[model samples]
Target: MAGCDVKNNPTYLLVVAGAISDGAGRWLMHRRPLAKAHGGLWEFPGGKVEVFEKPTEALVRELYEELDIEIDPAAVEPVSFAQHDAVDDEPGIVILLYRVGEFAGTPRAVEGEGIGWFTVAEIDGLERPPLDVELAAKLGRLFPE
Candidate 1:
């Protein structure tokens, strides 16, 4: 991983979660593990998308895999998109954010970490993933309550 640059490119799946529950507009967010980069900071739960997978399709899989919740792809609405500058020698990613206005099941950190739900306004208060915060700002514009 030395001498390799990962920026302004695609090597990760940038995802945003509108963790709505029972019709409320809160979102699900998590704290990155200490061993990971940006550790201890809050971030919406999601990760890199595999090649040849649609964003919606990939999101469903990721949510299930990482968060242990099943997401209906059709329930996902594209609210915004963003491209992030890479950090820590990591590849830049195209983060596509969608509003999951309707979904089924509860969200839990199936992977390994702390997780929670916050209202749109509360997002900025949390120390969030640098890239995810960008998407959250865009989401604010599309969903003004």
Candidate 2:
């Protein structure tokens, strides 16, 4: 119901929660555990939504469940979005990126293998999943230079 987001195409809404702590602006990312698909891939702290939940609601729940933070709700905003259609013999995914500068509590890996804060420059240095690699670029456009 917002922008040109397609409701189809194996679509996924990737919510990104970012902030600055310790005088450094770092984006929060988490690694998937071994039991899931794309396991071990570093992702922007979120998961898929059930049919009954809104994207924003899903984000708030995910943050509390996965990161132990309380989102302001009023501060979360969409920054950029991308559709990933892999070439050749691979699966395609669409990700909707988001941004926020504020939240409650410290960020820890509450639901996965690891959690870390990465500067925008360091984000590109990590070993990321296929379409997830574009997250930084999308976020850049969202927050601007």
Candidate 3:
């Protein structure tokens, strides 16, 4: 065990995010709370997948918790993913991005962060994490004009 120091290394996380789109083509974005990691950056609405929970299950749970909305698991379709490397002491994360086309209730920022709808072009200018930036690019390819 020459190089086995698990305690010194950050753990990996499985993060599930939704590219929640209105029927008209704009997608939802959530601003990270100032007290959280990646604070002040825009990200797709999602959160970490808990143990024993599937990715889609996590998406539904997270959306409700963060946005105060209900997402039907069947309404979410896997679209793309981003594998982010750990930086500094941060944990590496594999983000699974889903396209949520149908959901109930309005998206309110229950976590004291900003929420907004943006077109693909508008998303290009937002301050987002690298994983979100990649997810946005994939969205552009999926719904090109």
Evaluated with lDDT, which candidate comes out highest? 3
For residues 10-67, write the lDDT of model 3, one tens digit per residue. 3678999999988787999999999887898999989999878999899999999999
- Candidate 2 has a TM-score of 0.76
| Clashes (N, CA, C under 3 Å) per candidate | 1, 0, 0
In order of TM-score, best first, we have 3, 1, 2
Tens digits of per-residue lDDT, candidate 2, 1-145, equal 5665355433444443333232356777788886987888787876666566777777788788888888865777776555666556444555666576777899788888988888767777887776567767676555543
- Kindly report which residue stretches of model 2 are placed more than 4 angstroms away from their true locations once superposed: 1-23, 85-92, 141-145
**Better structure of 2 and 3 per TM-score:** 3
Top candidate by TM-score: 3
- List CA RMSD, all candidates: 4.5, 5.3, 2.4
Q: By descending lDDT, how would the candidates be arranged?
A: 3, 1, 2
How many clashes does the backbone of model 3 have? 0
Worst 10 residues of 1 by lDDT: 13-22
Clashing pairs in 3: none
Q: What's the TM-score of each model vs. the native?
A: 0.78, 0.76, 0.89
Measured with C-alpha atoms, the lDDT of residue 129 in candidate 1 is 72
Task: Itemize residue pairs with steric clashes in candidate 2.
Answer: none
